[model samples]
Target: MSPAEQAGTQPELTYEQARDELLTVVQRLESGGVPLDESLRLWERGEELAAACQRWLDGARARVEAARRARTPDEAD
Candidate 1:
């Protein structure tokens, strides 16, 4: 694997990392100087990164909801 894949672009990234890279992707897209093929690739990458971020968020939300449900009734007192 490439160094980037082995390190930065690995099998997973944390929510913050994914979101930061997505922000950079958006900026590159908005700057509007890339060739068509590279732009398409960047757009697709942005979509993937966005999806990864959503997965992290959804997992966090589910955990929070589960914890809330697990709380003892007396805890609300």
Candidate 2:
């Protein structure tokens, strides 16, 4: 399957899953065994995975912040 199709199939991967895949991509690129063209493709996929992971983390942070605010006593009380 195409990289984009594979990425879409894994919609909503947890932060850890996305991170692990990104790390693997980095390792592959660093190994230098791949052709330049394929390496570029991997780099692109890595970028997409990194963005997905960041989005997951951002959402989690927002939720945590919301929860914390909900529990805090009102200063105006």
Best TM-score among the predictions, by candidate number: 2
What are the clash counts of all predictions, listed in order?
0, 0
Q: Give the per-residue lDDT of model 1 (tens digit) for 1-77.
A: 32234345657777888899999999999999999999999999999899878777777788898898788465656
lDDT (0 to 1) per candidate: 0.82, 0.81
lDDT tens readout by residue for model 2, 29-61 = 998889999999999999889888777776778
- My TM-score estimates for the predictions, one after another, are 0.79, 0.80
Q: How accurate is candidate 2 locally (lDDT)?
A: 0.81
Residue 70 of model 1 has an lDDT of 81
lDDT of 1 at 3: 26
10 Cα displacement, candidate 2 (Å): 6.7
